[model samples]
Target: MFVIITYDVGEKRVNKVCKKLREYLTWTQNSVFEGEITKSLLMKCLNEIDQIIDEDEDSIYIYEVANPKNIKKQVFGQEKNFDELFL
Candidate 1:
Protein backbone atom coordinates (compact mmCIF):
# COMPACT_ATOMS: atom_id res chain seq x y z
CA MET A 1 0.00 0.00 0.00
CA PHE A 2 0.99 3.61 -0.47
CA VAL A 3 1.54 5.42 2.79
CA ILE A 4 1.77 9.14 3.20
CA ILE A 5 3.02 10.16 6.62
CA THR A 6 3.05 13.81 7.60
CA TYR A 7 4.38 15.21 10.82
CA ASP A 8 4.14 18.43 12.78
CA VAL A 9 7.21 18.01 14.90
CA GLY A 10 9.02 20.41 17.11
CA GLU A 11 11.98 22.00 15.33
CA LYS A 12 14.31 20.07 17.64
CA ARG A 13 12.73 16.71 16.90
CA VAL A 14 12.03 17.18 13.20
CA ASN A 15 15.51 16.14 12.18
CA LYS A 16 15.49 13.11 14.41
CA VAL A 17 12.08 11.90 13.27
CA CYS A 18 12.97 12.50 9.64
CA LYS A 19 16.14 10.51 10.12
CA LYS A 20 14.19 7.53 11.43
CA LEU A 21 11.72 7.63 8.60
CA ARG A 22 14.47 8.03 6.04
CA GLU A 23 15.41 4.46 6.69
CA TYR A 24 12.06 3.33 5.33
CA LEU A 25 10.48 6.07 3.24
CA THR A 26 11.43 7.10 -0.28
CA TRP A 27 10.40 9.58 -2.96
CA THR A 28 10.30 12.44 -0.53
CA GLN A 29 8.70 15.75 -1.43
CA ASN A 30 8.86 18.83 0.75
CA SER A 31 7.39 18.02 4.19
CA VAL A 32 5.39 15.18 2.75
CA PHE A 33 6.93 11.72 2.82
CA GLU A 34 5.63 8.77 0.86
CA GLY A 35 6.41 5.08 0.87
CA GLU A 36 5.00 1.66 0.21
CA ILE A 37 4.62 -0.43 3.33
CA THR A 38 2.34 -2.93 4.94
CA LYS A 39 -0.18 -2.10 7.65
CA SER A 40 1.64 -3.99 10.41
CA LEU A 41 5.05 -2.57 9.61
CA LEU A 42 3.66 0.93 9.36
CA MET A 43 2.03 0.59 12.73
CA LYS A 44 5.27 -0.62 14.22
CA CYS A 45 7.11 2.35 12.77
CA LEU A 46 4.48 4.77 14.01
CA ASN A 47 4.63 3.27 17.50
CA GLU A 48 8.36 3.73 17.57
CA ILE A 49 7.97 7.26 16.26
CA ASP A 50 5.44 8.14 18.96
CA GLN A 51 8.05 7.33 21.55
CA ILE A 52 10.45 9.83 20.08
CA ILE A 53 8.00 12.68 19.52
CA ASP A 54 7.24 15.40 22.06
CA GLU A 55 3.53 15.21 22.66
CA ASP A 56 3.32 18.83 23.75
CA GLU A 57 4.31 20.16 20.33
CA ASP A 58 4.54 17.33 17.84
CA SER A 59 1.76 15.50 16.06
CA ILE A 60 1.51 12.91 13.27
CA TYR A 61 -0.91 12.00 10.53
CA ILE A 62 -0.38 8.57 9.05
CA TYR A 63 -2.46 7.75 6.03
CA GLU A 64 -3.08 4.19 4.89
CA VAL A 65 -4.06 4.38 1.24
CA ALA A 66 -5.54 0.95 0.94
CA ASN A 67 -9.24 1.30 0.28
CA PRO A 68 -9.77 4.04 -2.25
CA LYS A 69 -13.43 4.30 -1.31
CA ASN A 70 -12.85 5.23 2.30
CA ILE A 71 -12.45 9.00 2.32
CA LYS A 72 -11.94 9.23 6.06
CA LYS A 73 -8.76 7.27 5.62
CA GLN A 74 -7.19 10.29 3.97
CA VAL A 75 -4.80 12.58 5.75
CA PHE A 76 -5.77 16.18 6.42
CA GLY A 77 -5.73 18.58 3.45
CA GLN A 78 -5.58 15.67 1.02
CA GLU A 79 -9.30 15.48 0.44
CA LYS A 80 -9.47 18.81 -1.32
CA ASN A 81 -7.87 17.47 -4.46
CA PHE A 82 -9.60 14.12 -4.14
CA ASP A 83 -13.14 15.27 -3.58
CA GLU A 84 -14.30 13.89 -6.91
CA LEU A 85 -13.01 10.45 -6.06
CA PHE A 86 -14.47 10.22 -2.60
CA LEU A 87 -17.28 12.73 -2.36
Candidate 2:
Protein backbone atom coordinates (compact mmCIF):
# COMPACT_ATOMS: atom_id res chain seq x y z
CA MET A 1 0.00 0.00 0.00
CA PHE A 2 1.01 3.62 -0.47
CA VAL A 3 0.25 6.91 1.16
CA ILE A 4 0.85 10.43 -0.09
CA ILE A 5 0.88 12.87 2.82
CA THR A 6 0.87 16.57 2.08
CA TYR A 7 1.28 19.10 4.80
CA ASP A 8 1.87 22.75 5.51
CA VAL A 9 3.28 21.72 8.87
CA GLY A 10 6.31 23.64 9.97
CA GLU A 11 9.61 22.00 9.26
CA LYS A 12 10.12 20.87 12.84
CA ARG A 13 6.69 19.32 13.25
CA VAL A 14 6.79 17.73 9.84
CA ASN A 15 10.02 16.04 10.74
CA LYS A 16 8.37 14.68 13.85
CA VAL A 17 5.51 13.28 11.82
CA CYS A 18 7.93 11.67 9.41
CA LYS A 19 9.82 10.11 12.27
CA LYS A 20 6.68 8.65 13.72
CA LEU A 21 5.68 7.11 10.44
CA ARG A 22 9.18 5.81 9.82
CA GLU A 23 8.66 3.40 12.68
CA TYR A 24 6.06 1.62 10.55
CA LEU A 25 6.80 2.66 6.97
CA THR A 26 9.71 2.61 4.60
CA TRP A 27 10.46 6.03 3.20
CA THR A 28 9.86 6.00 -0.52
CA GLN A 29 10.86 8.78 -2.87
CA ASN A 30 9.24 12.19 -2.95
CA SER A 31 7.42 12.00 0.40
CA VAL A 32 5.43 8.94 -0.61
CA PHE A 33 5.28 6.42 2.20
CA GLU A 34 4.94 2.68 1.64
CA GLY A 35 4.36 -0.35 3.80
CA GLU A 36 2.54 -3.64 4.05
CA ILE A 37 -0.14 -2.27 6.31
CA THR A 38 -3.16 -4.05 7.64
CA LYS A 39 -6.51 -2.30 7.53
CA SER A 40 -6.50 -1.78 11.28
CA LEU A 41 -2.90 -0.63 11.41
CA LEU A 42 -3.35 1.68 8.48
CA MET A 43 -6.35 3.29 10.08
CA LYS A 44 -4.56 3.64 13.35
CA CYS A 45 -1.57 5.22 11.73
CA LEU A 46 -3.72 7.61 9.78
CA ASN A 47 -5.61 8.65 12.84
CA GLU A 48 -2.41 9.18 14.68
CA ILE A 49 -1.01 11.15 11.81
CA ASP A 50 -4.07 13.37 11.68
CA GLN A 51 -3.95 13.92 15.38
CA ILE A 52 -0.34 14.89 15.30
CA ILE A 53 -1.02 17.48 12.67
CA ASP A 54 -4.46 18.41 13.87
CA GLU A 55 -3.43 21.98 14.43
CA ASP A 56 -1.64 22.25 11.11
CA GLU A 57 -2.77 22.33 7.54
CA ASP A 58 -2.23 18.88 6.12
CA SER A 59 -3.71 16.31 3.76
CA ILE A 60 -3.14 12.62 3.98
CA TYR A 61 -3.88 10.38 1.03
CA ILE A 62 -4.08 6.65 1.46
CA TYR A 63 -4.15 4.46 -1.62
CA GLU A 64 -4.34 0.70 -1.56
CA VAL A 65 -2.94 -1.35 -4.39
CA ALA A 66 -5.65 -3.86 -5.20
CA ASN A 67 -4.59 -4.90 -8.64
CA PRO A 68 -0.92 -5.25 -9.38
CA LYS A 69 -1.90 -6.61 -12.76
CA ASN A 70 -3.31 -3.32 -13.91
CA ILE A 71 -1.12 -0.96 -11.94
CA LYS A 72 0.63 0.51 -14.94
CA LYS A 73 -2.59 0.93 -16.83
CA GLN A 74 -4.33 2.44 -13.86
CA VAL A 75 -1.49 4.79 -13.06
CA PHE A 76 -1.08 5.99 -16.63
CA GLY A 77 -4.69 7.08 -16.81
CA GLN A 78 -5.15 10.84 -16.92
CA GLU A 79 -7.05 11.04 -13.70
CA LYS A 80 -4.38 9.25 -11.76
CA ASN A 81 -1.41 10.90 -13.39
CA PHE A 82 -2.49 14.44 -12.78
CA ASP A 83 -0.76 14.91 -9.47
CA GLU A 84 2.20 12.78 -10.46
CA LEU A 85 2.85 14.96 -13.47
CA PHE A 86 4.27 17.76 -11.36
CA LEU A 87 6.92 15.38 -10.07
Cα lDDT tens digits for candidate 2, 1-87: 544444455565677777667666665544556656667777887778776775645656666775534455323433332234445
Off by over 4 Å in 1: 67-87
- Could you say which candidate leads in lDDT? 1
Model 2 error, position 27 (Å):
0.3
Locate the minimum summed-lDDT window of 10 residues in model 2.
Answer: 74-83
The count of residue-pair clashes in candidate 1 stands at 0
Kindly report which residue pairs in candidate 1 clash with one another.
none
Q: Please, what is the whole-model Cα lDDT of each candidate in the order they appear?
A: 0.70, 0.59
